[model samples]
Target: MDDGGMPWATARAVGDRGEDLVCTYLEGLGWAVLDRNWRCPDGELDVVARDGEQLVFCEVKTRRSTRFGEPVEAVGRDKAHRLRRLAWAWLEAHGQRGAAFRIDVVGLLSPPDGPPRLTHLQAVA
Candidate 1:
């Protein structure tokens, strides 16, 4: 994590930084972020938020660079499917039903010496 703008070492740090940035961005857009790193038997969801009347399950992928590809490209069909399942699990655990939900992806590129980039994809599933 970056404390006082100091970067940390490790992939987890990058992810945490990306999530923090995304949360701020979403909040700026009037979305109320609810759960972060929500986990179930299925897997972990990076973020969950309410965009007005809709529930958004967001998966965040972050990288130092795009040498391989954009971070959002890492999420394939399998991952999307799992996110859907996880969304259901979250709803079931919370005893909520008939709620409108959507899957979203937030791709981040945070270089060591420059401003970070963020891409928000809606309805990924």
Candidate 2:
């Protein structure tokens, strides 16, 4: 069976590619990436970086098409809450408690035959 449309492995690969693209895009903006695929009991953080003096936890949503909706629309309030909790866990794990941080969402629409489109939203929650 397929996940949504693509197989599970294919979907995961696409998501990974999207995260890679987001990481490069952030680096291009001069952000130093601290981690990728950081996971805890609560959940996983797609990307973590330092933007100037602030820490950023990025959630990546990738879609092969927008037939259902925009990729960013995938992040709902529940997901945002989970991300916030995961951010705290990450900070604690890295001995960065009480650090200034924000949540960001990177949405990628990767068409099968065209270049991927990226959208970055900062301070989402």
lDDT of each: 0.88, 0.92
How would you encode candidate 2's per-residue C-alpha lDDT over 42-76 as one tens digit per residue? 87999999999999999999998888788998899
lDDT of 1 at 68: 63
Clashing residue pairs in candidate 1 are: none
Using lDDT, give the best candidate's number: 2
- Cα error, residue 35 of model 1, in Å, equals 0.3
lDDT of 2 at 97: 98
Candidate maximizing TM-score: 2
What is the C-alpha lDDT profile of model 1 across 1-125, one tens digit per residue?
23234455676777888999999999999999999999887789899999999999999988887776888988999999999999999988878766899999999988899999888899999
> Model 1 reaches what TM-score against the true structure?
0.91
| Stretches of model 1 off by over 4 angstroms after superposition | 1-9
lDDT comparing candidate 1 with the true structure: 0.88
